[model samples]
Target chain A: MSDPILEVKNLKKYFRVTNGVLKAVDNVNLSIQRGETFGLVGESGCGKSTLGRTIMRLYNTTEGQVLFNGENVHQLKGSRLKQFNRDMQMVFQDPYASLNPRMTVGDIIAEGIDIHRLSSGVKRRERVSELLQTVGLPEEHASRFPHEFSGGQRQRIGIARALAINPQFIVADEPVSALDVSVQAQVINLFKRLQEENGLTYLFISHDLAMVKHIADRVGVMYLGSLTEVAQSHELYRNPLHPYTVALLSAIPIPDPEVERKRERIILEGDVPSPINPPPGCRFFARCPKAMPQCQVDTPRWIEVETDHYVACHLYK
Target chain B: MENILEVKDLKVSFHTYAGEVQAVRGVSFDLKKGEVLAIVGESGCGKSVTSQTIMRLIPSPPSIIKEGSILFDKKIDLVQLTLKEMESIRGSEIGMIFQDPMTSLNPTMTIGKQITEGLVRHQGLSKEKAQKEAIELLSLVGIPRPETRIKQYPHEFSGGMRQRVMIAISLACRPKLLIADEPTTALDVTIQAQIIDLLKDLQEKIGSSIIIITHNLGVVADIAQRVVVMYAGKIVEQGTVDDIFYRAQHPYTWGLLHSILRLDDDEKSELVPIEGMPPDLLAPPQGCAFAARCPHAMNICLNEDPQTQIIQDEHSMACWLMDKRMRTEIR
Candidate 1:
């Protein structure tokens, strides 16, 4: 509707392995409106995390531009880069490995604040406590080490750390995958509440489709370093255009026993092809049930099949 | 159908440095022959502990089976079996698979050797015969190029394939019971579906009773005929798959069901998360363990643990809300 808070144009990130260059994120494009949650979903090694990190400038882009608020994120340096860092943050997947075990929870949360020189001494302490409270942790929890807290509590601390710098955009990469089901619900709710309160834009990346559907205004499905489908959460789930998207949706086991038993699942055959020197055609051609002879040779063009829904598949064309 | 496995009043505890942690408190359930039973719970809820205890996998020095009997084939109390005798039954009579395939599988050995080792030791098959059997097992689990893949090490296989190899190894001896502890948790949703389907297909062919231990209700619904809902080291609810999903009684079970972001549901509906964490295993609460987090926890629920109330022929739950007296009081 309004100007996109974050925009990606022909983004690519490649790692030169011994064999070949691993195209982790290839020719990707996306735009996230202010206060919108853009969910990125795919299996492991599907470049969801890579795309998130590339957008956050955690990795140097192999190609293309990340425009944050009309400013090229790749070109920003020194004070401007520092300002970008303050405005954007990331909540990592693993709470156990992400947080330093040696650091106190308060110190960990305030690391961003300290780096940005936002507060000092008593004020810093108060800010840390307030952030801890914001993420549903008590003030006393700030004194405890990461090991003292449970997995769920540790995740809350991670969220608090991300929110410390008051970032307008946060890239949460598989933030709740490690958490238990009930605890995951709590964290998701917290994310929703924080987004509402702060008017934040989130690049919420996860392999869990159901979770992404719950939190994301729009959802994007990645398959082996390329986005296969992107659409409104409800629209995508209801009528998945890409064969990969349809299979992925069908594969997710519903908790309802009756539906689960009755449903005809499209269980995709074969593992995701290696990203290093990936196949020339559609990445999902190997396993796609509806793949044709042309699909094996011709790379499908990304097209807007519906009013807002987009898909990259020969079938859509 | 006769129950293949029956766990009665099973109580297990770990002797920690801090204190004795009661992991499983008077848990009991029965698994019919050729049926799939799923034990669903969050971490520290003792679902894994119960399954491990059934397989006699927990280390005994720190972990102790305090009271109860795990009767296999209605005669053998697995708890009473000596280590020597249990070893005989471990793989041949009951096979177990863990979550992480990389760790469970040996790095040095070929996939063929790993699968055949059990066949040779337990079934007394010749090296050639065992190797042939291993290839067949691999093919059975849907691993392509079973002959060539069998020679390769675990590292050569993909995550999904490695898991298939794990399944192949587990089913080599053709045990009467197969215990899969979060078999697909580490896998992607598509791979997870494939694995579940493979397990179901293999179950039909082998006809071994399955006990799938997982925290995911979705996975439970996909593969299991019966479901057991555990909370804070206790079996809070047990019923048929339909009963557990549609007619759940325990507040904990309801909370668990409600908390999950279901694909079929409207995306806008706010998830009702169970407030507060699972009780500390070291010093669990005196009353119902889930009472603290349960939305409908009553005074009695906070004060005393409720006894298992049989709802129907095969459905049961342990909750004050399920009690006839509580229902009458509410009316």
Candidate 2:
């Protein structure tokens, strides 16, 4: 009913190699509503991360456009670009590698505040202390370096830094994958609480299906460099349409021994094909159990097979 | 099932500049012959250290096995064995599959050479004989075009294929005991499932006892017959898979079960994460190691560690809440 907060239109990102052109993100289209989390999931090297980077304008797009609030994100410059940077923020995967080891926790959180001229001096210090308390960290930890804190605490600092800018949209690339299970739950809960309190939209990127199912409102499944399915999170998990989505969902092992032992897993055969100079047909044709001869030559078109559920597969066609 | 490996009161510590990091503190467990035992724990909990210590792989000086005995096959204390003696048993009698297949494999060596290296040394096979056997081993792990793929280097293989190669190399000598430390951690969910299935299939065919150390509870349930939950370098709970999943008694175990998002779990259920961090191993708590983060910690739990209480057959945990003596105090 409301205008989408972010719209990605036929986006493509490619890298030239000595051998050939590697298609990292190819012809992806997506729309995210305001104040809702859109989860993008795929296995390793599936271009989910590349798509996130491209949407964030970290990488120069090969083709197509990214629209944020009806304006081309790539075309913005000067003060508008600065405003865009403040409005849109990113949370990286590894807190150890992302945060500056030399900077104190206060400095790390205040960097965004100072850059945006949101506060200065004592006010900046006060804001940093407030953020620390918001994320469940002690204010005394502000002066301490990141190395002194544990993995979970460091991640909370990272979240604090992202929240410092008061961004409306955040692209979290595998934010909790590096954390331990108990710590992961804490961080995921933090993300949810922050989203509710800030009225924020998130593009949550991860390879973990269960976490995506738990945190996201809408879910997209990426294969190779293309989206194979998009649906409401519960809808996708309950009745996955695309062959790839089915295989991907079934591959996740349930923690309960009874459920895991009773359920028959759909273990797809063979490795994912190389993204460089990919085949003309469907990317999943090699491993799809329901693949048809036509699927080997013609790529399936993305279509809405049901209300609010989209799939790209000949089986649905 | 008879015991294949018995580790009793194993205390391993690392001498660091800061202090002595007690990595594995008083850990004791046994592996039944042909059974799969999964050691489940987060990082810094010493699951990896415990498994590597079984292989005598940790270098000395920095690491010291302060106390305990690692008895193999009801005799032969592995902790007492010299490096030279351990080498004889390393590949032939015991094998290990490391976490990262990419780095674990030698980049320059061909897959065939890597696989045959163990067969040649441990089995006294000729170069030609070992090479032929290497092809069979690769195919046995479900790798296609074994002859041609064997000649290719590690970089040419994908992550899953490289993991398969690692499995082939580990099973080359058909060791009686295999320790796989996070064998599928680096791979994708699909590849992880494939590797798990491969490990399960091969374990049945080889009839060797396996010690799988991983943080993934799902993978443990999929492959392991028994589970051990570790915290701060010590095991807090251990039981059969059914017991750990259905009737777990430890508060720490409950936290783990509640924290993880199971595939079948409804979205409405909230995760009850453990509140605090694991205790520093350099100066581990005198009480229960999990007491700092545990929700059911009692006054005694802060002063003294609870003894292991057997909740049921083959299921035990170290927690004051499970002790009947503490029930009166709680009332």
True contacts kept of each: 0.92, 0.73
- The residue pairs found clashing in candidate 2 are none
TM-score, candidate 1, is 0.98
Stretches off by above 4 angstroms in model 2 are B328-331
Return the clash pairs for model 1, or none: none
Q: Which stretches of candidate 1 lie over 4 Å from their true place?
A: none
DockQ (C-alpha based) per candidate is: 0.88, 0.82
Tens-digit per-residue lDDT, A1-317, candidate 2: 86699999999999999999999998899999999999999999999999999888898889999999988999999999999999898999998998999999999999999888999988899999999999999999999999998888888999899999789999999999999999999999999989989899999999999999999999999999999999999999999988899898888888888787798989999999989999988999999989899999998898999988988898886
Q: Write model 1 residue lDDT over A83-118, tens digit each, in one string.
A: 999999999999999999999999999999998899
lDDT (tens digit, per residue) of candidate 1 on B108-157: 99999999999999999999999999989999999898999989998999
> How far out, in Å, is residue B167 in model 2?
0.7
Sorted into a CAPRI-style docking class, model 1 comes out as high
